[model samples]
Target: MNLIHRAGWRRGILALAVASLLTLAAIEVLSDEPEIALLIGEPYKAMRQRSTASIDPAIPGHSWFNAPKSDARLRFADPQFGFVTPLARFFTVGFSRDQRIDGVRMSPQIEPLLLDDTLKVVLDLQEQWRNAGWVPIRAEEFPSFADTPQWRDRLREVKNVEKAYWRAGDKYQLMLVVSRFRDNKRPTEERYLITLGIHRSRGVQ
Candidate 1:
């Protein structure tokens, strides 16, 4: 090959190598830290905004619900698993202008989710809170998991709203309710609303 041709080929090879390196660097940066806000969506954003406004005296410290959206300590709202609480410190609070349900406030703009999604939320919350001494309770109005299988098929097919109750420590109580309703924006589709609240226990401790 001529000297001129050889020089052109070397330049082309070097340019391709540099481009490949830049592409790899970009991919590494993106994979290292994904966007938590985009992963969770508007429900998370709305709850985060309200986390600081209403304080629950029973909690008595920095609210995990108030954690930044990107905080590594929180995980929630998975489509396949419903909801996940990998870290016990990651918590959420719900409040609204609407009437309270069983003495706990509800959010007016509750986001619709899938039944599977809601189930996962309840399960994860129950598991984490149980580790913290929150015992499951049976009630006429709400669903109880005490006797049911931890991994059950009957509950996964449910397409309506359901509620669960738990008591923690000596004075605090937790309530979680999941409602499946029609999507306002997409009328043909159905979605679930997963609301949670914490309050002073009214029952005998």
Candidate 2:
């Protein structure tokens, strides 16, 4: 995906309002990819969340409500199997179509490693997600490693958003990361994305 960045200035408390408008304007004329929000009109239950009858060491194969986690913070059983601790947390809030929130509060108690030193702030207050401990890793560890099998089996698929755009203005930027995580497609997506964003992107720092 080709990311676009725009610069802006704020006026006052109404700065948010101004920036939001400018962001919309930038997006309107920025690129030529007809706006297509990821297909997330409906949510499917991950197989794992479907049956909690037993402490299924085998990570769920279904969706959440179907096999709910005792701790909402625990995004996956073997985080390596999916987005690690904090990353899992950040990606889970809107994972379900039902609990989608436009904004999320960053966890003051965030993992230092997960924090993108370059991008610095992973997801800003209005960025839609916050790292709650879930981290990202290669998908091979999970059974779905072969193909990222299903959304429930792939960590990347879980993090993908339906509609995301960044409005760069100040210390805190407004951005959205849309699209469902690749279901077990590329096992090394995190490594690839990290390499791309950090090594390829210039202003990340």
**Number of the predicted model whose TM-score against the real structure is largest:** 1
Cα lDDT tens digits for candidate 2, 1-205: 2233223332343688888899998866533221111112222223224322222222234223221232222222222221211222122222233422212222222222221321232233222222322222222332111122353233244453322222222212222222232325554443112110100112221
Question: Candidate 1: where are CA atoms >4 Å away?
Answer: 1-110, 139-141, 145-160
Candidate 2 worst ten-residue window by lDDT: 192-201
In each prediction, how many residue pairs overlap at the backbone (N, C-alpha, C within less than 3 A)? 3, 35
- Candidate 1, lDDT over the whole model: 0.47
User: Candidate 1 versus the native: TM-score?
Assistant: 0.43
Q: Return the TM-score for each candidate structure.
A: 0.43, 0.18
Deviation of model 2 at 27, angstroms: 35
User: What would the per-residue lDDT of candidate 1 be over residues 1-205, giving only the tens digit for each residue?
Assistant: 9999999999999999999999999878644542221122233344334332233322223223332333222323223322223222233333222312112233212255555655565666677665556676665556554325542444444464456787654555656765556677876655655566556576833
Candidate 2 segments exceeding 4 Å error: 1-39, 46-86, 95-205
- Give the Cα lDDT of each candidate: 0.47, 0.27
